[model samples]
Target: MANESVTLRQIARKVGVSVGTVSRALAGENGVSDRRAHAIQDLAKQMGYRPQPLRRQRAGAIAVLVGTSESGHPDEDWSQRLIVLATRASAELSWHVHLEFVSRNDDSRRAVAVPTVVRENRVDGVLLAGDPHSSIIEYLHRHEIPMAMVGGRAEKTGCVCVNPDREQAVRTAIHRLFELGHRCFGVVLSDRRYPSTEAFYQNCRQSLADHGIELSPRQVLENLQPNLGGGVIAARRYLAAGEPLPTAMLFTNDWMALGAMMTLLEAGFRVPRDVSIIGQDNLPWCNQMEPALCSMDNREERMVREALVWLRRRIEGSPCEPHDVTVHSELVWRGSCGPAPRGSAPNGAGPNGAGVTSPAPAKSRQADPSSISLASPPGAS
Candidate 1:
């Protein structure tokens, strides 16, 4: 009997208990006395009665909370990608995935006012899909909830965060543009409050400084929305600024870049002809545009996978230090960017020598000018 087909029935027979009692004991379920459960579990272990994988215990479903816009709609492109990837990963792990949308503009104090899922205790953990307020994060910590952040850093709160290397991605963009002979540069950003947005701005400024170039205050266009309308507004501002526009402009994301591209075309400023442009988040539509958008590929799939892994570890009661996982981005060169416009100074030209005149002092630290590094792109002399 010990050598032949070890089963719960065999264990029950050996322990003088019913199969139900054996099952409950092996599963650590209540109803069986602690002493009896321990004895049955030990007997099953000794009798080589292995539990089937299909009956393995699970930590329950995870909740993915995404931030919605002012209109109460989540960013479809970003939110969808994260949900799909997380769902797929959860399926493989035999865990369920539940998605919840929260407003980006919600007051931090109000955001944690007992979400229905939390009150019902439906999920074992949470994956914050975007930059939620620190207050909400702190609330989760106080409740002893297992949580991980995606697409934003949460180092202060000791949450494991998975994000694209924004600084390095911006640096790569600058280097690529420099290689293409673009010295003078500009950027269009929205939502200064977002950590990701601030990172992009700071990194872009720092990268230019490292290349011996100055990012003038006028070069940055801010206070716009994150959508196409924002792009249109930014375009209007750029056109109104008059002559000597920076030869290369970087949009915070693809939507704005495409929107601005349409506006630029309508204004008779031929893209890559009058002013080259680059965007981030290499969205699918980028390639279909009149001129394919040159942007950074943020590797959304990898970002989600990393976030889920950390979340699963937390759910399993694994001990891990707070970690910041950075997935590097790739530069997707497209027709949107080209060599600097004619008469523009070459790549190594200083701010004064470039076609762009240095604007007034920057009000923010990101605008501070610094000396250029001797670093050259790979294979450059």
Candidate 2:
């Protein structure tokens, strides 16, 4: 008889255990005790028994759950990018990707509904692309569904997460600005509450403190949206405060940074001349702007790859320790940032020609925006 054709029932008969126990042991399921599972697996391997391939076990479909805003509108830019990356990665693994959008309102009573894929049992695993509500995550956990969170956190739900290293990104941005002769810094933040945003704020504060810098309350702008209109409001508020402006500013993302730049230019503040600014996401328009925006490039490809690997393991019934995976962010240098303005510093220079001490100049290079795909679906903003 062929060794690969050895049956689990034959192994169970030899091991004096039920066929179900032997099957769980060979499949790496948790029903069987560790001692019995190991013994059965060893005997099966000795007998040259081969478990069935994963492809034959079930349908090869994965679901991606995207969340809509409180107003029930989809965020095309972020969501589209996430979906594109996920689809690209899934293709390599021979898995189909399906997108499901969950819209929620302010009322907690009306929670986010379960995804249709889960209801229909069409997908083997799920990838959460955004902040789908806690209730949704809880439902998945209760049902014992294999799921991983991408670009978001689900620690409370015990779901593995793959996201950008926001703390490291903030530190890199601050260090780069410091080397460029910027001391005082301002930060623009969106009002939306998410784990990554919270991580950004905490890391920014810690990084500034590490440099013996104090982040003043006036320097932090919060509760603003993450759009062009929010950027306009932030600029107006900063200008009307009548307080001394920081030499460097960091916007949470590119859209708000572009909006703030436009508003500042209209008000006669020359970008990187009067003030240096940086943004995150390294979007396509970063290079098209008159003064190209310097931003952080969040490695979406790597994030997707890691998330898919974890999800694949879960779907294949492979034993994997749940852990968070974080992809580092790279600083994409462009034309937006420059040396701080003369005489704008509160303290005189320490023989460095400015208020802040400048370190030895490091080699800098401009990033090729063409290297990254910024294309979106038709009508996508």
Q: Using TM-score as the measure, which candidate wins?
A: 2
Model 2 clashing residue pairs (backbone): none
User: Could you give candidate 2's per-residue lDDT for residues 177-223 as a string of tens digits?
Assistant: 77666777778888547666777777787887777676777778987
Worst 10 residues of 2 by lDDT: 354-363
Instruction: Please identify model 1 stretches exceeding 4 Å from their true place.
Output: 1-59, 70-72, 105-111, 345-354, 357-381
Q: What is the C-alpha RMSD of each candidate to the true structure, in Å?
A: 14.2, 12.2
Candidate 2 residues lying further than 4 Å off, grouped into runs, are 1-57, 70-72, 104-110, 346-381
Tens-place lDDT per residue, model 1, 213-262, is 87888779986777788788887787777645677888878878877877
User: Deviation in angstroms for 291 in model 1?
Assistant: 1.9
